[model samples]
Structure formats: C-alpha cells, structure tokens
Target: MYGTALPTRPALHAEWIKIRSLRGTVGALTAILVATAGIQALSAAAGTVEDGSLGEDPLFAAFFGINFGQIAAIAFGASAFAAEFHNGGLRVSLTSVPNRTRFYLSKMAVVAALALAVGLAAGLASFTAGQALGGASAPGWDTPGAGRAVVGSGLYLMVMALFAAGLTAVLRSGTLVLGLLIPLILIVSFVIGGLVGGPAQYLPDRAGQMVLRSVEHGALGPWTGLGVSALWALAALAAGWLAVRHRDA
Candidate 1:
C-alpha cells in the first residue's frame, strides 16, 4: 500500500456523493428556490406606478433572494463537513487519505463545486422567475451581461460556503462554529450598518452584494466588493488548512 498513491480526484467525488445524500442539503436548496421564486412572484404581481417605472427597481428587484439566499448557501456548504465532525467521521476520512490537507481540500472542493452549481441555478431561476413575474419584459438569459449575475452570485455563494467550512474546521464543532459565525455574518452586519452609516459599505457581506446588484453605488466597485468577500474566505480557509495540518484527528 505504501508504494501506491491515493486518488485525490476520486476522494473528492466520494465526498460529493456523501454531501448530497443528506436531507439538510435538500431542505436548504428547496428553501432557496422557494424564497427566490416567491419573492419574484410577489414583486411581479405588485401593482406598478405611472411614468413607465416599476414600484421596485429591476436590478435590486431581481435579487431579492440575496438576503435569505446566503443562509441556505452557508447551511448547504457547512452541513457535510460539520456533520462528519459532529459524528466523529473525520477520523475515518483522515485515516483513508492520511494527508490532512488533502482531506480538508477534498471536502472543500466538493462543497465549493456544489455551492457554485446551486448558486447558479438558484440565482438564474430567481432572476428569470422574478423578471417574468414582474410582467415588464425582463432580459433573457442569453442577453449580453444578463448571465453574469447568476455566475457571480454562484461564485460568491461558493466562497462563502468554503468560508463556513473553514470556520467549522477551526472551531471543530458544528454548534460552536454556527453559533459564532451566524451572528457575525447574519445579525451583526445589520446592526453595524445602521450605526456606521457610510463606512459600513465595506463589510464583506455588504460589499459582496455589489456583484449581484443592477447598479453599483459605493466606495467599492463590483470587482472590489467580490474581492473583499474573497479575502474573508481565503483568510478562513488558510486558518482551516493550518488547523487540519497541525491538529490530531
């Protein structure tokens, strides 16, 4: 066995199978789809104002899912990795590969890939459904640059998911990681935004929305906003890698 090498790609494939098999993933994705569709339907059916303008801005209107979507994305991303740890399954995973980094990366790769897929489908579906619901002749998927929002949203969600996975690794417990991260990502950002006024523009979650919005109005540009969020993910991932490398299973 020493002379033979481990199949890194296959390990990732195996992890992929393991994650989607869980009920939580199905529940999370279902919530995202329903929330997005329902928001679009409401906005669409809402009565329009005069002067040929929607009561809601189409750009922001199309992305109502961004708010709750993040929660579903995080739950889906962390569920697999966190579940294994919660159930003491990490020992089994690490034992199979014995390369700690590989194990973490394998899980990361699988989770990130699924996040990207789910993000794209959900974002696009929300945009399409919302626009159609609005009854104002929204842009089609093939329309130039019309597709970027879905792709960007997907990438953003994937990064955030990986970020969650990293947090789980560092904390080493599902409940603890969720406890610490939920308030920081979900709750506190809102409170800080209210108090800080202008500078709250730079918070990772706030800035990350730039990629999804129809308009960009802030100190941070579209790419810059995505970069800020990426920095958070990278920082968490680095910490996770370090933890996995140095700690015992």
Candidate 2:
C-alpha cells in the first residue's frame, strides 16, 4: 500500500531512490571528469600553458573543468528539488511527511553525498589524466604545493555543489536558483572582483580559485582558499536551513 504516513519508510526510501535515479545528478559527476580531464587535454594540445609553466605543479590547467563543470553542478542542484515541484511531487511529499523540515533535510543530505562522491572522482581523475598527457608537468609531486592543489581541486567541486544546493533550498524553485547561482558565482563574482580592484580578491569564488593552481597567487594559500570556500558553503547552507524552516514544502 502507498504509505502516506509522516516520516515513513516510503518517504526516506523514495527520496534516496529519487537521488540515485536522477540522471542529471549522476551525469553531473561524470561531467566533472570529462570537463576537467578533457579540457586539460585540449589545453595542453592548444598550448595555453608553456611546457614548464606549471613546472612540477601538477598541471594547473587541468582545472579548466572546474570552471566548465559548474554548469553540470548547477543542473544537479536545480533538479534535486525542482523535479518535485515540476511534477507536483512536492505536494505529495509534504503531505506524506507532514514535517517540511525533515523532508528538506533529507534531500540536503542526499544531494551533499552525491556531490562529494562526484567531486572526489573528478578531482582525482583530472590530476592523473592531466599529468599523463602533459608530461614533465610543472606541478609534479616534486613541487611544494602540488598535492594540496590536487586535493583542493576535488574538494572545491564538492563545496561549490553544496553551496549551490543550499542556494536551491533558499529559492525553492529550480529555475530561480539555477539562474541566480550560476550568474552570482560565475559572472557576477568575476565582475565584482574585477571592478573592486585588488581588494575583491577576498571574494569566496576568487579565494577558492587558488585551489585550482599548484601555487598560491592570491592573498590566501591553498588550504585558506578552501577555507574561504567553506565559509561560503556554511553561509549558503545556513540560509537554506532557514528557508526550510519557514517555507512550505
């Protein structure tokens, strides 16, 4: 029987199934690999960075995917909640669970887990593939910050996805969240940093950008860059939690 009970097995199981079964979410992770690694290959072939540009730096250019993969990340975040709204499943879910908070929290957990797995895979694959292709890469393990950059690139993806998911929670509409987050992080953030001059360097996205490089060019170092990104994630997630508490499911 269709159980419409509050916080029942059906709701939790259904949500889990929904996250796994969602094509957009699954494919987003895969794109992380394709975007980062594929672009790295292209960049190497294109001669964007010189042979020793990233000398022992682990091929910083491989992170081209981080910029590209944001598109897929945006899609995953939007679909995480938007699909339900589009299909009127949100109504049914709310009715079944009765507690909006629990329903929303469950979705957040599932989405975060998905993002983490995809991010880690993308980060590791990008590094390995980039190095193999760009032989004598600048950021090889011999470099001082090579390892950190490699690890941080992967972590950065996870954080960005988390930030996007939280943004979706706040907006509660797929189109709105996607529209806002993409521009805010990609376009607006970049512009503001450019206009604000040297000081804009502290912005979350810019700060996090350091992780993509084998060397630290910004005010903050690799770990600090990640820390800046984490702050944004926390802030965004906090906003989302408030939305979950106040808004109807």
lDDT winner: 1
Q: Give the lowest summed-lDDT range of ten residues in model 1.
A: 47-56
For model 1, what is the alpha-carbon lDDT of residue 111?
80
Q: After superposition, how far is residue 52 of candidate 1 from its true place, in Å?
A: 9.5
Using alpha carbons, what is the TM-score of model 1?
0.83
| Candidate number with greatest TM-score | 1
State the C-alpha lDDT per candidate: 0.70, 0.68
Off by over 4 Å in 2: 1-13, 52-59, 188-199
**TM-score for candidate 2:** 0.81
TM-score against truth, every candidate: 0.83, 0.81
Which residue pairs collide in model 1, if any?
A: 44-133, 44-134
> What tens digits encode model 2's per-residue C-alpha lDDT throughout 1-249?
223323445556778888778777667656766776677667666666566564433345656666776666666766776767666677887777666767766676676667667766777776666666666643456666667666777677767777777777677777887787678678876566434236556666667767776654657776787788889888888898788667655
* Residue runs of model 1 more than 4 Å from their true location after superposition: 1-7, 46-57, 137-145, 192-197
